[model samples]
Target: MVNGEFYRRYLNLPDPYGQQETSFTMLFEFREFEGKMYLKYQREEDTYNLFNKTTNAIILKQSFMKELFVNNVLPHQTHAPDATMNMNRSVEGQAKPYNEAFWKYYNAPVETARDSQILKALSEMESKP
Candidate 1:
């Protein structure tokens, strides 16, 4: 499992944006926190990584969710009526434009040197056009 556990439930979900029957394969691990279960870790296969490519490699998208608290409060949408996303969009679109302060406050793991370098390169490329 590539340095990870696979005893948990695994899912093969259809990629909404994909054509040619592409799908995303996900592996999830759950943990009990405060007497309730929550997603501890998830590993998702990138649907775009095709076997037809010259490179014999697969990209796995992994996410580690933490600092979860049961609010018991109902969530209401604040998105515009013309929104293209249903439930995928985060509240107020705060997911983008990475905020250092927000991540630090939430105790998110700090990015390593390799991560920073990759982000810097992507930012430079995006800024070009």
Candidate 2:
């Protein structure tokens, strides 16, 4: 099991130091596509500083466990892309619109939790009604 502390360190979040302990919650949506698992997620948490209140971020990750370990295809390489420039140009044009929409919809506020002093201050703020 991956703990909150692992994420804090991985994301380079600041330690709570002598102040209150920091807390984090992650929500993920898992999907299986073409025999691979994709995890789309968002994380929300209090800052290390008391005054900053809450912070959040989104992430996407793909897992190829079956292909790598079960199928033993890690050492094999797939066929190369077509050498046709027209094919590539058309695909790139089609992809741009899709990429733009995807990012705009999924975009959210993101910040590092590595500032201990700032987090400590945010933690001490009054709760909302």
lDDT on C-alpha atoms for all candidate structures? 0.49, 0.40
lDDT of 2 by residue, 18-67 (tens): 22324444455555655776543333334332222243322222221111
Candidate 1 C-alpha lDDT tens digits along 17-124: 212223446577776766767666655553333222234343343433223233342235375554564436543452358788877768667899999999999999
Model 2 misplacement above 4 A:
1-17, 47-129
* Model 1 spans with C-alpha error above 4 angstroms: 1-18, 48-87, 90-96, 101-129
**Model 1 deviation from native, Cα RMSD in Å:** 15.3
